[model samples]
Target: MVLNELGARINSALQALSKEPVIDDKAVDALLREICGALLESDVNVRLVHNLRQNVKKRVNLDELAASGNKRKVIQLAVFDELCSLVDPGVQPWKPRKGKPNVVMFVGLQGSGKTTSCTKLAAYYKRKGLKVGLVCADTFRAGAFDQLKQNAARAHIPYYGSYAEADPVQIAMDGVAQFKGSKFELIIVDTSGRHKQETELFAEMEQIAAAIKPDNTIFVMDGTIGQAADAQARAFKESVDIGSIIITKMDGHAKGGGAISAVAATGSPIEFIGTGEHVHDLDPFSARPFVSKMLGMGDISGLVETVKDMQLEKNEDMMKNLAKGVFTLKDMRDQLQTILKMGPLNKLMGMVPGMSPEMMQGFDADESTRRLRSYMSVFDSMTEAELNSDGKLFDTESRLRRVARGSGVRPVEIQALLHQHQQFGQIVKKMGGPKGMLGKMNPGMMQQMAKNPGAMNPNMLKQMGGMGGIQNMMKQMGGMGGIQNMMKQMMGGGDGPGGPGGMGNMQDMMAQMMNGMGGMGGLGGLGGMGGMGGGRR
Candidate 1:
């Protein structure tokens, strides 16, 4: 099983037990067996999988537990905790200070995506408004500098590399000194990789480390290597101070579990995981959110970070208009643009609480993007007044005919787009008002939002799938806790005036929840605003 399949398998096992009235030893053993099988199949270290199974079983302790114990919750929590421990080495990753230059060195095998990972890391920090520069010291590879130069140019990031230099150590020293002298805050040095572990490779790696003295030396392991990742990571670690790890090529790698477990064995924390070929596909590794995503529980923090990274908080006018449930053709176009900026549709879907990767397989990214473009074209064909209106002008036959002819699309397609707009507007309108349902939602995020003016208004919540999305989220949070109580649980089960992080009150919690929602660049998927109810009338 792959990572997605592994999570689905565990979720299925737990879901089966969730439906049972009585939790017996036989059922518990069966569930553990299924989970263990999934983990083993995913190429997790066999010993680690065994330890996890035993730990979960020991913690459950069905024989000693009283009748008062909620057996299901106890088992679920145990599984959750053990799963978190699977990849967590219980260590802190390297943190870069704001005012100082943090030189990070990248190392891995020849085909382990070390160069691309370096560029991706640079892009990650670049998106955070940091002064980042890339240094290509992999002179051993034929086109290493060219590749890094091209990637750096495409991302508009400043880079330092020497095409004439054959010595990686000299180039690394020069690059680091140059970037540091320029006051670059995050400078990444890319090192060469050999076909196999050799003395020359280790010597050069150690020389580069000594030359630049990087604050973090990340071992970029290829996730497709299965159990071999353990040996490979250990070889690199024996040569240098491997401060962190970044597992690459996990998008569809069945053996990704092995690489992750292998890193855990080396006692190095995983800083990130590359999920796709794009620079933005690099995700910061967080244990709980990763496990939650694996179990179909969603990664709320990842979603929020994506939103904040996009700087969506600057759109105050958009929030105000959305709160009024006032959506026009122009607003739809803006939403479509935001969706495009947020990245792939399937990726966005995987971030939602109840959305599974399997469920999102049906969404063809290219087809959907073309469809969004067609809708934008239709809007372009409309008059300025019509575009700004609530699409009521399209109700007339002549108006429809004119737009269809102007946009070179069928009349029915135009009607379908209009109908979708109407549905969206209606949903938004029904979400909240001065005396409506907005008062009853997750208050923690809402509290966070209250501090940031225009980050999330009541109207914006309506724009985020209205009540349907919230209900779906509540259902995924075990259905019985309700929004307020679930908010409490999400806030680390705290009480009194403030919850975790000094949340002022229930209103503050709601604000925080709202802020999180607003920061979700993939809000369209989370709110169920996708599909638009079909393509044609």
Candidate 2:
């Protein structure tokens, strides 16, 4: 029934051609018409879609497929491949070199999150333990300084913006100079958003770049703009060395593909993406997933990346625990916590192949994750033997009693966790890590995760089993617990380069995850939730 969409769309257009082997002018025209409608409805750029149709018509050998009785099937594959090629599978937003202090210059129409992103970038770099500096060069807007200043405060980094300075370029120059010889390894300039007419402002930005000679220049655009992305990206590209782009407001945009597709022509890679106004809402942009969705295909690579990036340095602990073939109540707690770090689990799951959108429509992703997290908290209250060793929680009576006395949760919740862990055990047992840690991990991201901590779920932590809980956790981990324990819990079993112990503690993970997610100012929903783990909902 489901294949009917792609199947039916193809068949309806092929009826006349299917009856005859050679698809002449009429049949070819008909097939193109069907595809054109589908592409246009999906919010694809009209001219782009038209161009694609022309290419497909010229290339596809309709007569051969019709003769083989597989015209529709062959046609679908061709359309899919062409569409995929159009999207460009592996375009990353921004991947600055290790030691290069990437100067990601932010640009957008007014109120598209430039100031917010600047602080987020500063925090991202800071968490990486890189010396980070901020330049509030957006002197044009009424309250740009106040806005950017507020964000800088959230990140707890230094910033230079002058109300009297008037010249944005000068402010950037001063900001760049102030951090010289200091710890900050990365410098982000928060420039004011302007219209195409502002050539003077563009020249000023050139002056700033000439002064700083930034490693990367990022263009921040609102995700809601769709096809207009062409004009916006072009305007910025004309003025300076626009190296990358960031698409913001993704959490709310309904027709976001235009903005997603428009920048391909600019020769500028989209580096960071903003989902919301929150600082942690920023993520490195990858084009594969966005492209796959447009063609109605699943995006497996994004899932792999999210899982690899989400787990900080602690997935090793999970692997080690799994390798030992052990699953404790504590391990269950940690597993659930790890899932939180892995992010809105179901959404991440949706990126996997065969994960149907219709299937997701039935199951509420956020609510289910919340239920699972609560179950994990309940399991956390059990004794060491109950958590670590087998048979301690074997009896249903013990499970019920443990649930009631410890986390104020129900027995049913505990039952579910144990059941799920059993399933997980079976799954892990079947998996063979071909490259082992090298197979499952992203080296750069893993390194960053080791340094950054997940955000705090104030309400969850406050309500779940109470104060000094983190202290208790630290004690259980024997003083080394805190973040290292969490990271070990994250990457414990993995043989990745980012294995723990080298990772410092919560302070580091916090800075890093904050910087990676959206830093202090962008701690909204899943962004900050990535760090909260046990505290996260």
Candidate 3:
């Protein structure tokens, strides 16, 4: 079974136990059986699955627990703990020291995405205010340096490589020395790979590892390798003390369970997982969240991290402008870009409670991204004065035609963009008036809210807006379960909760923005949108 199917099966097993009239050993055995079957079907090692089942069964003794101790909850926790242990080696992951030049060496077989992974790692750190540099030391693979150079350039990361350099060790030494002199904090060296393990491959890898004295040597494994990942990881670990692992192509792989679990066998914690072909698709691996997602529980921690990583609080001026209901076409453009930078829409959606990566496929995430780009294109075509003004500029047919022509889009499309802007304006108007719903939100609570929306007390939600804020919104939308159903319908291109009559798109967009704002003081920056409608004229 695919990972999603495995998750559903495991969830069903747990739900079955919850529904049992009385907790009993038979029910527990049945639940464990179901879970084992699902894991085995997903290509998880049969022996590992057996161990998980035995461990859970041993811990969940229904008779040993008092009536006060919930048997169902205990069983569930046992399952979660075992699953986490399966992927976690109980080892500390290597960290990059800020002041020093931390050299990270990447190793893997051919087609394991090592070169691309190097760039993705560099890009991840570069966004975190680090001076990241890349070194192309993979001379064994023809055009490896060229590929790294191109990726580094696209990500705007400085890199060192010589087309004439034939010796990998010499190239690695020179590149490290150069980047160290430049005071680059994170220097990633991409090394060569072979199709299969050979003495020569291991020898070269050992040589490079010794020459660079990297802080971390990461083994990049192909997620589709199934149980074979264990052997590959062990082979690499034996050749060089692989400090970490990164499983690649997980988005399309069915044996991700096998790949991830196998890495633990090599005693190395997985640092990241490549979810897609994009450079930003690399996700920092956290065992609890990974197991949580696998069991159909959303990655709440990951969602919060993504929001905090955006550093939305740093835009104090924009937040102030938003509080005054002064949202402009420029502000809208910035938000659109921020949404893009927030990572893949599907990935973000999967972080929501009751949502899964499989279910997110229906969101037409790629289409949503394309739509945002088209809207931004129109914004780009507008004159500075026009962008800074309200929707009045678009009211002039001549101006509409000019922007449409410049953006190479139809006037009707431009009109659609304006309609979206108008919807946002109305939302702001409703929430930012003198007695606006969002006026009472506390700026100090923004960070706390972003960390975990579910933990936000009802009073705090009420302060952000009337009717208990997000809690009320979730209730009216039928809670997370109802939200899933509504999303499925919306994904099918039907009208949303705001009805089919023009308000459907606006309702969806507002819900989206609210969801994104969950941890950002729950609408702290949206306090001043009431003046937006007035600004347009």
TM-score leader: 3
Residues 1-537, model 1: lDDT tens digits: 148888888889998998987898988998999999988888888888999989998898877765755888888878888888887788888977787899999988888899889888888888777899999999888988999999999888899998788899999999999989999999999998863448888898998998888899998888887877777777787788989999888787374778877666678988998888888778888777788777766665566566666655555544555445455677666665666677764565465565545554444545544555665677789898997888887768988898888888777666656665665566445553433333343434333453332244556567445657555544432342233343433234232223332212222223223323443212333333211111111
Residue 202, model 2, lDDT? 72
lDDT of each: 0.69, 0.54, 0.71
Off by over 4 Å in 3: 65-69, 195-197, 325-330, 381-427, 441-486, 494-520, 523-537
Better of 1 and 2 by lDDT: 1
Residue 476, model 3: lDDT of 40
- Report each candidate's C-alpha RMSD, comma-separated, in the order given: 10.2, 14.0, 6.7
Question: What is candidate 2's CA lDDT for residue 39?
Answer: 53
- Please provide, for model 3 over 1-537, each residue's C-alpha lDDT reduced to its tens digit, 9 standing for 90 to 100: 136677777878888988998788888888888899888777888888988988997897776885645878888889878878887888878989888889999988889899999999999998878899999988877888889989999999999998887899999999999999999999999988864447887898899999999999998988877777767777787788889889888888375677876566679988898888898899988777776766556665666567667776655544544545555677677666666888777776665556644565546667766655766788889889988776777777999999888887777666765766666666555554455444455545544554444355667766767445644444443454554565555455533223222223533443445433634343332222211110010
Q: By lDDT, highest first, what's the ranking?
A: 3, 1, 2
Best by lDDT: 3
Whichever of 1 and 3 has more TM-score, that candidate is 3
- Model 1 has a clash total of 23
Encode model 2's per-residue lDDT on 308-394: one tens digit a residue. Answer: 455334545443443334434454455446556655534444433333344334344455456556555665677666776543355
Question: Which segments of candidate 1 are over 4 A away from where they belong?
Answer: 381-383, 396-409, 431-537
- Please report how far candidate 1 places residue 375 from its true position, in Å: 2.8
